[model samples]
Target: MDRITPRQALRMVVIAATALCFLMPLYWLTISALRPEADIFRFLNPFGPWTLIPNQLTADNIVGLWSGSFSRAIVNSIVVALVTVIAGLMVCASAAFALAVIEFPGRGVVFTTMIVSFLIPFDAIAVPLYSIMRGFNLQNSYAGLVLPGIGNGLAVFLLRQFFQGIPKELREAAMVDGMGWFRIFWSIYLPLSRPALVSAALIMFIFQWQAYLWPLLIAPSNDMKVAAVALAQFSSAYNVSFGLIFAGAAFLSLIPMLIFVFFQQYFTSSVAATGSKE
Candidate 1:
């Protein structure tokens, strides 16, 4: 076995400690959810082992969530995220393909404008967007929830960067063999762009998944509320249920973590490829 130097051992200790610092809140949230409603705050003031570990566990919080609009909100969030991922990928990927592979007037200008769009704050345009959705009679509809997410600028930029990394020879060869642009994109570019596609899917999925303000503005009704918005409704001026809040937070936080863990390799690949190319 290789012996560790004192400096290397110290580095490992520091890294472990840093990781624990970040994980502590998540650990507390999970345990708080499992704890009895009263016990959820009992351990916080004079913090001790009990603060980190639940002595009496209960499933009431978790069970109660499914009995209300929270369940519907989770389903709504899933539907919205999936739709955004599928539709966003198609729209962004096609735009990326055009920007990267096709020759057109003002392509550079168009791509630059897109790159600038993501930098703008969504909050700045939320009210105007809400008005537009209402005007189109899309308020309280999934279409309203999904339309804004489909034109993800960062996803387009990421896909376009990855697409640019592919050799032009492949596209040229396909064209020489009478392959149409759509066929060439479908048969060649897509098969080779799995990592980029996964990355873009994650972006669009996260955009819709974490949506709060937009969903609140566009779909205020209980039937159309998403998980984030539903989480907020758990609180009230009269009484606040910290147990339910913690439970909902734990459930909401677990999803993105699972997704990122599952698709982490593809995400890393796409990020590295994008950075290296452009």
Candidate 2:
């Protein structure tokens, strides 16, 4: 192998430094989770050896987190995420298809309005959303969790872009053959748009899984709480348990990491395709 030049070496150093900056908090969390509770404050003795003593390793924190309502929260998060993905895909895909394929009046206006809606922050809608849910008696229910995720403006925009990229000839030929619009969509458009679908699903799943504020505000009970909200119940200002808190956090991190790993190829390909079109 050729030796790296000065420029290459400098680039490598910059990349390494950037990676370390991102990974430092994660490393600290893992180390803190494994350290004995007493040694967590050892940073106060700046000159002391930084070694993690072997006796500090314990599964008590992990076990405790799992035994409490944490496990239930994990299940709740998984269910809500899956439901959200299914609901979002069904609604967004159909809406995208209509906007892309049909020549309806006000189509451009409607599409533009949907895109503009994405700019509105969730905080702006929280109060009105809560009142609407309260009126429907959906608070603290799975329906409450899944309903909000189904109407994402970004999902509709992304799928519409992908749908518009489909060749017009294919749809025209399908129509000439007397095929219904729905059949053409199912047979041609959807199969070719798998990459976009997977990409959108992965993004939506992460957003739903890690949602904190809405779930926290609407679903405060143990039975309805998601993992992000449940994790907060473990810590308080005065009575903090560093090991257990970190353990719970580490466990929570793994869920999204696994989802991303599973769909990483589709995500990369879809993003590359989207970028190339622009």
Candidate 3:
């Protein structure tokens, strides 16, 4: 490899600084979770020498967090996020394929409606959705947790944009071969749209993972609570223990981190291909 030029060295420095900026908070959280409570609040600012290395490391916090109701909540979160990603992928990808490939008079109207729905936050429809779910007797159930999140408008929009980038000839040739729309979508488009599918799944996964309000609204019972809601349950009028809270949060952060690491390649591909329509 050639020696690094002055300009390249400067760019490398800037990139390192940016990475450090993001990594510092995670480092702090990890160390704080590892340290005992007395060591954590020894300084006014959390970035003191005490917390820097955590000389008095302890696993009590992690043990306590993982051994309690939070453990069940974590499993609940996994179930909800996985289900959301799977259902969201199916619904969004199918809708996007239709909007991108199929010709219909009201297609534009439907797409525009979906785009508009993106502007409407879930809070706007929470009460009505709760009423509907209650009518169906699905509250505090996995179906209730998963249904509200499927076919997210933004997921459909991104997948549709990606789908539109595919060559028209592919679908036309499949049509000429007498393959139905579903077959063409399955064999021709889905196989080629891996990046977009992974991208949408990651988006919905994060969305469902971080969800608090919807789950709290419809599934407030301890048996049905998600990890995010369970995090809030740690706080009370009499107690505000940062040690346990931080440990629980740090543990919760691991799932998404592992997920992103696994999907890192597809995510990069999806991002690079975002605007490159054929």
Runs with alpha carbons beyond 4 Å of true place in candidate 2: 1-6, 43-55, 237-239, 267-278
Worst 10-residue lDDT window for candidate 1 reads 234-243
Q: For residues 162-227, write the lDDT of model 2, one tens digit per residue.
A: 999999999999999999989988899889999779867876786787688889877888899998
lDDT against the true structure, per candidate, is 0.89, 0.82, 0.87
RMSD of each: 3.1, 3.2, 2.9
Give a tens-digit lDDT track for model 3, residues 140-162. 99999998789699999999999
Worst 10 residues of 3 by lDDT: 43-52
Off by over 4 Å in 3: 43-48, 267-278
**CA error at residue 57 for candidate 1, angstroms:** 1.9
Q: Can you write out model 1's per-residue Cα lDDT over 36-154, one digit (the tens) per residue?
A: 89998788989788888789989998997778668888898888998889989999999999999999999989999998999988868999989988999998899999999999899
